[model samples]
Target: MTAIELTGVTKRFGDVVALRDLDLAVEDGEVFGFLGPNGAGKSTTINLLLDFARPTEGRAEVLGMDAQRRSQEVRRRTGVLPEGFRTYDRLTGRQHVEFAIDSKEANNDPMDVLERVGIAEAADRKVGGYSKGMTQRLALGMAITGEPELLILDEPSTGLDPNGAREMRELVREERDRGATIFFSSHILEQVEAVCDRIGILRGGELVAEDSVSGLREAAGTAQTLEVTVSRADEELVASVRTVEGVSNVTASGDRLSVACDPDAKTRVLERIESEGVTVEDFSTEEASLEELFVSYTTDEQAASEQRGRTSDGKNSEGEDDERTESESESEEVRA
Candidate 1:
């Protein structure tokens, strides 16, 4: 069974619709990254899963239980490390974990939990004196109190240094290895790309895309970078490559030229550079980064939606003439 599933889920706040008819699912035992910009209803979806808010239409299920009807049960089996997690200033790290353990009626030792999150030495230190990164680790410690079947992490790497961030990734894997499903949501694109097995991107309060990083990159149709090693690199050569029909970015460093262009244009790019008395030594292609894929999917989806809206609004008289001109220009560009 899927660890989490939402079917036709729609949420609204008064007159404002927060989520459309959304259908999403996270398979059991996989780390699923939830991504979106602000005001994208990511928090709203979390609230619905935890029953902090009710969906205006459709169903939400967590661990095979109704999110609204059996919320208590669902939460009991799920562990959450919320965004900007708070702690009592006067309490020690041990005390915080103890509280969480008691609240969950868990048998986990507070010190063991603290140790797992790399805060055992600071177990007795007042949280008021902790660094932001340490505090994040402590909160993550609390979330693992009962070895929950599902883990939901919201910006789990916030305030952590590179080392702590690395540790967080390890711990996430450890939990998954021990049979837990992780729902990781964060704006840290690289971290998400490194850790998540699959991801679902939310845009404008709807799920715009979902897949593994490579899969999404393919679906988004973003350009790949061709790093070509050449005998010589110069300004004239860079400028020549820039005018390639599908080329978007061209840069030179030492004897290498990094060209961002459509897959079909790679041969043309190399030929253009070679034509300029430059010997092509060696070259390699790199996939687009997660960050680039994010922008493309989000912006492209919005652009497509806007175009459909304009078309549906109708074009007549003078407007039709202008539309024809625009279409002709676009077609000519495509043909070129």
Candidate 2:
């Protein structure tokens, strides 16, 4: 079942287009990570999904219902830890959870939710004095009040320490195990990579890449670096390894040959080394990290735009300088 679907959805704020021709589908019972740099329209897409804003074109559906038409029903079944959520300063943390429970008409012990978020000790304390991390925990506690089937968490680990972030990921896993579909968004690639089943990357108001974690790594053309340690680095052996199919590049160190190749070629390369009568002392393979893959995709467009800007400035620099000189002369004449 599709938990959330957006088809040809476009949102604009007067002259500024926030999202354009966006299409996405999140399946049931999977944790989907929405990732992008700031101002990439992640929030706008979420707003459309929650019916907080109407799309200028196309439609958004949450839990198989039109988001705008069934906004109330959607809220009832969805728990949101919204980005930049503000809590009542005077209210106690326990009161916040209780309020959510009451609003959802859910029978839940507020303390349990508080404990789950690791804020039980501070539950009865007034929120006015809570730290930012504690306040984030309080908001999370409220989000889980009714065991909602769908959870939309935007930057859920904000202000959390390492331990707290780990705990949050654990809770995400727990919720997913309980059959909840979680749509999580964050700029922190490590956290998202840790918890997400599939990830979608948005760039310039469009869905740029969507796939499983490994699938994305593959799409990014990330290769595995294989280092084969031999008793002696042989030039002939290295040349043979380079000729193997899927092997992109090869370099030799003192006693190690580092080969960059497709992951599937690792075995073939290793087999060929033994075939060449070289004794393999040790070998190690390092695959591309998610962080590297993320930067490659997200920064490419930005880098291109910057290059274009530089080219335009270079072309007009002489003209701009001449205009500046003419303006200064005109100003001096007026003064005279």
Candidate 3:
């Protein structure tokens, strides 16, 4: 079941078009990452879904309700943390959470939400005195308090430290496991890569790519980087290791052998090293991260757009020249 659906949704502000024929679908109980660079219509699409901004054309539906006509009903069933969010500065953490629960008319205990977010100790502290990371945690506490069926998080990890970010990702997963569909928007590729089941990449108000991290990696033709460390380095062993199936490139540096290969080829490479009398002290693998994937898609899309712009410019120039020649011929006839 789809929790959200957008078909040919278009939104504009005066002359600036925010979304153009945007089509998106988010599955139930799945963590879907909405990815894009700054000004890529990620927030606009979210606004349309929330009915914060009405679309100029097309349709949007959330939880089987028309997004525009039944916005309040949709809002009641979904939780949202908008991009660069700020909470009530004067309110204590507990106060903020309890307020949200009251607004939602939810029966859940506020203490449980605060504890799950690791803010139980600071629950009585004013949010104005909280650190950026603490404030982010508080926002998340409120967003998840009502146990809404769908969570819409925008840049949820922006102010979080590494540990805080990890905890936030865990919370998202926990909610997903409990049957909530998470539609999160972020440019922080690492967190999204770690938590999201699938991703949609939007560029210049258009969604150009949508797939799993592995699917995008395959599409990008990305190779895995493997590093194996041992007690000692052996030149002959490195060369021999390159003979492993699917090992595309290999090099030796100090006590480690670095190999670039298919993601699934690491086990074979390690097995071959062991068979050849090489002792492995440590082995690690790194695939193309979401950062790499985002950059690859954005670069390709930018290049394609520039090429189309040049082609259009050339066509317009040719048409102008033809128009000038026709005008000159008409003037000559008048002179005759």
Query: Which candidate number would show the highest lDDT if scored against the true structure?
Result: 2
Predictions ranked by lDDT, top down?
Answer: 2, 1, 3
Model 2 weakest lDDT span, ten residues long = 308-317
Q: What is the TM-score of each predicted model, taking all chains together?
A: 0.74, 0.74, 0.71
Looking at model 1, the pairs that clash are none
Model with the higher lDDT, candidate 1 or 3: 1
Error of 3 at 309 (Å): 11
In the range 53-130, model 3's lDDT, one tens digit per residue, is: 999999999998999999989988898888766788998999999998998998778889899989899999888999
**What CA root-mean-square deviation does each model show from the true structure?**
7.7, 12.2, 13.3
For candidate 2, write residues 1-336 as lDDT tens digits.
899999999998999999999999999999999999888899889999898899999999999999999998999999999898788999999999999999999999999999999999998899998998999988888888899999999999998999999999999999999999999998778888999999999887889889998798776456777888987676666656655666656668898998877888898888777867788899998875577567655765333333323322222224244543444455456557
Instruction: Please rank every candidate by TM-score, starting with the best.
Output: 1, 2, 3
- For residues 55-108, what per-residue lDDT tens digits would candidate 1 score against the true structure? 999999999999999999998899988875588999999999999888788999
Which regions of candidate 2 are displaced past 4 Å? 221-287, 300-302, 305-336
- What is the lDDT for 294 in model 2? 74
Indicate the residue-level lDDT of 294 in model 3: 74
Candidate 1 regions exceeding 4 Å error are 217-222, 225-261, 264-287, 300-336
